[model samples]
Target: MVCMKDPTVQTICEIYEKLSKLDNLSPSKNVDTLFTQLVNTCIPPYPIDVTKLCTQIQIIRTKLIRLCGHAEGLLEKHYSTILGSFDTPLDHLYIFPYYSNYLKLARLEFDLLTQHCQNPTRFAFIGSGPLPLTSIVLASNHLTSATFHNYDIDGSANSMATKLVQSDTDLSNRMVFHTNDIMNVPGSVLKDYDVVFLAALVGMEIEEKMNVVEHLAENMAPGAILMLRSAHGARAFLYPVVEPRDLRGFEVLSVYHPTDEVINSVVIARKCPIPTVSSIDHQGFVTQMTCSKCAEIQVFNHQIEELAMEEHIC
Candidate 1:
């Protein structure tokens, strides 16, 4: 078994220690055993000290991301195993979902984005790992007019995702895959995309993120939406989530937290009439939006579904 020492780290810390040493980066009986334990431990956003739990989650996730690189493409390999075992992708999808339950976890985010963006026809999914569940959902759901483009840095993943799409002939036609590092992806390609999805687990550092933001700020067509998956509470432990500050180039339209679901949050942003020094006028402007009734923009509010009603911004 893999071994590491951490007095305060607890379960995930121990799991990380074991996982880091997986024989040749392949999942063995030990890996499956540990995965079972992990699923039970992390699911069910329990009513406990979430801050501590989330921190542990993030640490384990970050470590997995780092270790996956050396594991001979083993990170997403296990997911393939799981998918193959399923009778139909949708059979246990809502339950088992992706390895990290990313789609199920981010269900709230997707639901919220769909509600607000209504008829987005052009979509780009960045860092769509081997599974490409997000792209699959978008294509399958919006077959009428939506076009989904997927970009990934991993050549193997890009290839696998392409095949997965082709496996569903209908989906294949609507979705296009590209193997390109997010930092290297051309701004012109994303120029007309109505919506761009930046996965939370996207393996990118601060510098790369900055490069992407700057590129998008310069390239994405005006009025395009950037759907950023953000981590919150314990879900933040899963991946490097986005912060409002990271998206200075775009305007924050809304943030939605799917209650009783994943700990991650979603932020809907719009690139339009790029914020200028003048946008921040005297009465302490409300970042991207303005008060419809009065000048005082006191606080940020929840999304409509979350609050069961629309908020009056005044």
Candidate 2:
């Protein structure tokens, strides 16, 4: 339905061509002004490659952080400006049905995962922003309820999120919000959570993000799951792109797409046997599990490449 002749399509293609040519993907370095310009331009929402678009926006945001510094909460300021207030939040209104697609997609992914009825009933959501949208959606709709541990670095946004949670009696009873830097939290805090959601734009640098992933391995209770939120296809940069290649210290179980209009990818990973640094593979050791009774060990050669199964329909 979209024609190549459209100026927006032409501009998008041009941006892709430019990004493909650039050798340096460093955020510390200044990016071509055109890519940033292309992102901010009033482009139509029709049939766009959201993965590429979000990646480009992510580049622009990282550059902004590098140039402006996060000391004054520059990144949060920018994100909040774009998302606006959650009071009578547009996402909650869902005047446009697709507006809540992100939340629906998240819930669907959770369902796709195998849950033992006895699995821990606690979860932590990082970078929950002004309204813990996904957490809210899941907690309110699911047949099974779990405790939610939410965190945000921005003080004002954290307060707003807390207020939002309090406004709902069910959520106030079910959710807890913490105000702290996502990067600085002590690993001890990870002890109580069964699952942790890593937002794509957690306002941490690449190194900081990597540190969080590593710390989770050392701190999360045994059998805990880490649900990594990332932007994949279409406007991936929108969620600050993360691939299996960009991670360490956890065993990725699967890569899945939500059965909705939103095309972001959700990667589910779990803690593997802790190994010496020299023995670790791309992410972590190959999956290995042992039966408690017979002590029979099973080796799972499931790497990200071979992990995808028919667990969930996209």
Candidate 3:
């Protein structure tokens, strides 16, 4: 106002305000253009760290692209269902950015795990999506692993992960990729790992998630660490895609708020030793096992026969 607010300064300030409000944009055809403009204007000055700034912008752009892709894929895949018929653009946007939080939690978990690793340890990653890659990067940076096995149902995901890890010489020696259904992973096939990572796996349906957790619990060796990152809240307020169950045997190690809307919780549960039937008293309880171990009775039941066979053969 004093000097017409200096036109360039006014323009920059206007763009900054628009970018700040981009999160509030309603569903409209013009929203995309609004985001594009925001992205354009967020570019830093010429002397700034251009590579870092560009990477940040690309991350935001990638999030948007991934959201659109997921929405389109869901529509195509579930065309017969009511959800498939509904346009869920906002849902995609909401969940896509949550991965940024997931990445933050993953780094924390990786640091915690690395501090505890005394020997060469294998880390198995289930649902080897972007979050797992974040963990992989942390692991590589810290030189924490004996090796890494990344498993995903999507062949393309496996391929991408393999390519990414292989491109890094330090990570290349430590990472292997497996393209297969997580449900089909044999308990024996999973037993050697020291740590099992379940990132983004809980975002699946309840039954499927339980199945995956059950499988991980069964396959992991006693004393092995199972690290899980998932969206959590009471049922009503929680994300509806994946149902949250009681954490059960897992111990909540840390809960981090990486963003305003998203809370990333890291749970580290030691794979409790499955007590043999002979080890139980007449009441079918192991007197020495803790209350947490008692709660794991059902998980033990589902796994005992298979684990017994595995131990015998070994």
Candidate 4:
């Protein structure tokens, strides 16, 4: 637990209090000011035992996410209205102050994805909020030929996001929006995608984040690439962290923690093609074998017979 006497903790609490009451209206200068301060306050070299303060940190994280969501919504609405009056909406995308950030982040993800997938044709972006800037940036600047499927649970956010690109013919033809939870997406549909990106705020809690990762691992096509946003060091206070060990059905490829202004770390992994289970029987005998060339599996109990019932496992 974080001690109240800690100066950093006190400053963080004060900043959170101020941010909680900050105006969420468009042009949220005050909110941005406080958030900048919070970012500076959350710089690395945190006190020892930061893991013990997960609960407290999560409380602050939830508030921060809410604040960001509101600010994003306002900004999206403001831009959408302006774009509606223009002939080419995408031409003005750079007007957003943080547009370059999304551009850099998208380029980083693109470079990482290209390292493993030679020709990725389909991409599913989970938790794409009202702006869907990452998807827009990737579609507009990089991976121009790929089809993007943007998913968000909020109908209003989806409605707003659609407006941002509806007038742009290139994006409208390539970008698709769905208002549904990722868990509700069927495996049949998921199998069509070559890459899937999980947004940082999709699962704010560690358990929830792991559950989503496991779901993707279980449903995504074998050999499909899964990219997720994670945080390292003090950034964990703002976003949930995903350890490589937490990836059960996929083989982690790389974990990149940016020391620069980029907030979220990037994790890229590939779904294992085969399922091979190795478990010790009740009699203390160890059974281990690969189902096939690409199959890898892990049996929790002594259920050896169940392996034959399932065809292709991830």
TM-score of each: 0.69, 0.61, 0.53, 0.81
* Clashes by residue pair, model 1: 58-237
**Model 3 lDDT tens row, 18-38:** 544554343344554654453
Candidate 4, residues 1-314, lDDT tens digits: the string is 66556677677778878767754546657766876787787755454344665576657756665565566567766766676566766778887767787876787777667767888999999998777889998998888999999999988888878887988888999999999999989899999999999998887777888888878877899999999998776666566777777788787787766555667778888888875468898899998643221222211121331242232121
lDDT for each residue of candidate 1 in 1-314, tens digit (9 for 90 to 100): 12223323356566667777666656567765765555445444433332344554555666654553334246455565466455454334444334344645344455556655778888888888777776776565433568888888778787766655555556768888888876776667778788988876564344556667667776787778888665543344343556666676677777654444354567777775543334565887754542111111112233444444233111
TM-score of 3: 0.53
Better of 1 and 4 by TM-score: 4
**Candidate 2 TM-score to native:** 0.61
Lowest summed lDDT window (length 10), candidate 2: 291-300
- Most accurate candidate by lDDT: 4
Residue-wise C-alpha lDDT for candidate 2, range 184-270, written one tens digit per residue: 676687878878888766634667667677676667765577787654333432335555655455666666543234445677776
* Segments of candidate 2 deviating more than 4 angstroms: 1-10, 13-98, 115-118, 203-205, 258-260, 275-314
**Per-model C-alpha lDDT, please?**
0.59, 0.56, 0.48, 0.75
Residues forming the 10-long window of minimal summed lDDT in candidate 1: 290-299
**Regions of model 4 farther than 4 Å from truth:** 22-27, 43-49, 54-78, 276-280, 283-314
Order of all candidates by TM-score, from best down to worst? 4, 1, 2, 3
Q: Against the hidden true structure, what lDDT does model 1 obtain?
A: 0.59
- Sort order, lDDT high to low: 4, 1, 2, 3
Q: Point out the worst 10-residue segment of candidate 4 by lDDT.
A: 293-302
State how far residue 138 of model 3 sits from its true place (Å): 1.9
